[model samples]
Target: MSFKQPLKAGAVIATLDVGSSKIACFIAQMTDDEGGFEIVGVGHQASQGVKSGIIIDINLAESAIAHSVHAAEKMASRVIKGYPLRDVVLAVPATSSESHFVDAHVQMMRQNVTENDVRRALAKAQVKAQKEDREIVHTIPVDYVLDGHRGIQNPYGMSGQLMDIDIHMLDADFAHLKHISQCTEQNHLDIVSLCSSPYAAGLSTLVDDEIELGSIVIDMGAGVTSYAVFQSGRLLFAGGVPVGGQHITSDIAHGLTTSLADAERLKTLYGSALATISDEHEYIDVPMVGEQNARGEQHVTRALLINIIQARLEEIFEMVRQGLEDSGVEASICRRVVLTGGASLMPSIPELAQKILGKQVRCAQTLKVKGLPDATSGPAFAVSMGLISYYTQRPYEMPMEIASYGESKSFAERFKGWFKENW
Candidate 1:
């Protein structure tokens, strides 16, 4: 394996995960040495600023962001009074995001892979990707193919007559980008870099072997079901459907004739993705909104509740299966699917996902971090924890070669800044 130099350490890095259910803030200190980062602080608040999967209420979302960040800063015992924590690694949901795999091959000027050649090949991919209405947010190298032999992660230091690249390029609608930037600017926070939420979660939850052997990480978040297909330690494809755990709650509420809050409470306490009639022992209780009996008691049967929850979960898994099929990376996903995110915590989700996708499924959690309490380090916190890994694993050096090749930095830089600063 080739070693890329690590980013500067000792600096405080914060990550913002704005999702349908909540906005989470994570702050960590990168160690100067090669050890992974330490979680110095964390914060989370119920999200009121988003709907389905996109940011719809800017002011509310901004307030949520500010509150979460402030809590994190306070917990870390640091006063972020200056600059308002200008730099952040912001996680963008796939709601308004687009991803396409693009390849570029460049004839080698010499028999060796120089940094210049790699830069030119990547730039070619980015230019080709940004040719139309969308702007490229990330151009990550999927793999490097030198001559006839493939499977090269880093072609530099290897001898090759030509350098070929497979890149996963992420883009967003121009309007979405502008709106996000304006929203952050209004709050005096600049985004440093924008990372796809699914991709980031995959980085932390997926093991090296899983990526090499081909695996799918499915993030069953509140407002969206996001997925990433990984192979050879790179993201091959990522997409998100509009359905998520929230939809399940809504389905239960509608199907059971219950209030939203009651639906949510039932989902958390009694939801099951794979329920059999035999599992029903007794009737469960679901309170009626603004209506109570003489003893203030209301109840529903467990089997009825499970039926509603299971139907919704099955639909979600089917949607995930369709998303994997749409990615068209490989058929290997049939054997490997890792379930994550808040919804995955449901007791029967793993078995249900396995049955639906015909894959071995398990809930994923962040590993190789210290001082993370168990309560906050499960699949539910996968995205927030994964952001820490993303910040630590990213190469520190600027893509100077891409700049020297006469590539315009205004759009990419501004977009990257928005990602880096807003977290």
Candidate 2:
């Protein structure tokens, strides 16, 4: 299931996001308008068996997925009863993700280029992207070269003897992906496509200008902080650090001698990535770890909590900076950075990220999608919304390796007039 069937009116799409802190599921159906969709159901459960995007306890992970999917199904039933939730698009973390630029050249068969020519070049690179242990997540075209001249956007109508394409290849760890597959298959759901969470986040968060001009998207999940780079209206790279919001909560638990639950509550209620002098005077109740509920309560300044949160977030941003430098993308391409996901909800996250990374930073949520409740429209559901958006994109084909199943048939039916004219 490398490429999904192109979306059309009445086609249903379901997505699952397995994160370190939570597991979420969304069900949506394509609208009559082209590239328009509306969310019909949403459900997210606290993650139980997954740690750092790896499944440790198979049973626990399966159970969590089951509950999440069930809730989403229940909600969707109101709109369309008996909607089958069998196939789904999966969102995986960007841990161990890799990116590359490969060139594919093809000599034109006819005087005027055709869409088939472009597909052939992309298919050629798709063949080259076939690896032994890595699973391809995205194969995107960045540029077009025609007749030895670069920067050709569309060479279809012009005369060109030879054409080449610059393709961006993205892949992820096979073992990590397999584990999630096994767990999902156990829940009776077939995996149709797997997308890196950061790439998915970029689709839902970046506006048209950001996607066209160039920008970076950072998704601060519970277990991993993943990033994606976009330039000239294409995805350039994706990578991640092993630290995220979960670590900050852990730090708070250790520093303040509180339970993980209470630490999470504190982080949600009063956490800040940037601490201020006023925080020293603000006091909050901290329940002791060993003592009983009422007797063990103690008053501590919010400054201590902010310090712990700020220190850990700084390290995360530092690692993200090092990652971008190692990615080999030019600093000029990433004019601004956008933050999303669960952790980006903290106060002053944009300020802290800007200070540490030395780039313009802002927090973002899922943009332009409809029917998502307030709970699922925020930064936390960026990846979930992204999977829905990914469903609407034109599916790239790797003809030599993977077969074109439903997508080919659907395309033919949808464009029968053009096919008849060309043939």
Candidate 3:
């Protein structure tokens, strides 16, 4: 089952991000052999098919996916006809994803820690992950504890009768994965892998040192904010808040009596999460729908708009703080918080997040790529770039699918094929 042969040079792969606010498509070719990769095609479009971080209407989702992918293909001077681009590495938000830690102990059957022992321990951990009414999406091995020796990175080639493992498994609600699968399948695409949004963002933005020591990656999307804690190159905590940039837009629309579209444009061009009366002298031209006043009502001061957006942004970060606290991971460990996604572009968002999270925060930007537009290299492209980087590096583990024959049935087998639906 191993793809041992060297992949062809200039092998092109595609990544699709069906985000809350936008659907982004990326196509890149492997370069410099296996060490470096380069981008060749990219496309993005405003999403009308999704809402609240999940795909609700399959038809709309399919159209949106096709639009983004086609544009990228055109840019690459290629056409992915039919199901040529079926397999892909997909990213999903944490709103519907769940995670838990499981510990397993195996006797090793009078032998040292062997491959079978590792499999058995993983089986126990998987069973524990499915104890609740959810389906397992990912099973990650954190560390192994063999006999009295703890923190053993590899238990194999060591003499120990008792094999113990600490596993970090994630599960998503059945309905959530099914809807996503349907949306992609209807569009003639097959999800080869389902990646956590935070993990996907971390793939490109996080460096080796940051992951080894500790860092928090916060992916701020339109309708949801996803966070991940990485220590020793493993995902320690993952979760998301139900609120995001959409909330800020809603607040501005309510406070200023403007349409949602106008509020969004204002937020992108002039809104800041931190407001100061000293900076209130500047005024912005607001599009008026046949409304005018001698007091200059059509033009509004920037401070008022900032004040409204700031309130919502503050609440969202507070909820993120609460989520970190609830995960039992000390906030002190995350001295560096990297902000990515569309909402991270706000002028003073990094400063605002640092003030609230008590950590050094900065916007996440893409790196080491060519043929990409300047606008696509900013913090907003972190997830899209990460998706590309993920396919290039192939870092994450794939889900183990049960074989048809000669496969031992474990307690975790009950959830196999659970996600299949006609849709």
Q: Taking the tens digit of each residue's C-alpha lDDT, what string does model 3 give over 1-423?
A: 121222357666677788888888877766766646667778788886687678788788878888887777777664323325545667777888876877878887656666666766666556555645566666667788887788887677688888778777777776776776776666566565566788788877888888888899999889889998888777777899878888898888788877788788888888998987765898987654335544434678999889898888888889998999998765577688989888888889999999889998878866557777786787666777777665555433334431111133553244434433442
The TM-score that candidate 1 achieves is 0.89
lDDT of each: 0.73, 0.80, 0.73
lDDT of 2 at 256: 91
Candidate 1 stretches with Cα past 4 Å from truth are 1-6, 78-84, 131-133, 148-154, 294-298, 331-334, 366-368, 373-375, 396-423
Worst 10 residues of 2 by lDDT: 414-423
Write candidate 2's Cα lDDT for 1-423 as tens digits. Answer: 224446678878889999898999999888864767788888889898898877888789989998999899889889877888876888868875678878989888798777767766666566566565766677677778998899886576778899988877887776677777767776667666767789889989999899888899999999999999988777788888889998998899999988888999999999898888999999999998887767798888999999999999989999998989988877456779999988999999999999988889999954556778887788988999988777567355223123233223423232222212322
Between candidates 1 and 2, the lDDT winner: 2
True-vs-predicted CA distance for residue 120, candidate 3, Å = 3.9
How large an RMSD does model 2 have? 6.1
Order of quality (TM-score): 2, 1, 3
Candidate 1 lDDT, 1-423, residue by residue in tens:
222534456666778888889888877776675635777777888887787557788888878777877777667664333424556677778877877878989888788888777776776666556644565656678778999789887787888797788777777776665556666665556655567788877887887898788888998899998888877666777888988888888888787777888899988987787777765775777766565663544566788888888888888888878877777778464378888889888888888888889988988855557656565687767888777676566542123224335254554554455444544
Clashes of each: 20, 0, 0
User: Which 10 consecutive residues of model 3 have the lowest summed lDDT?
Assistant: 398-407
The list of candidate 2 runs beyond 4 A from truth reads 1-5, 293-295, 366-368, 397-423
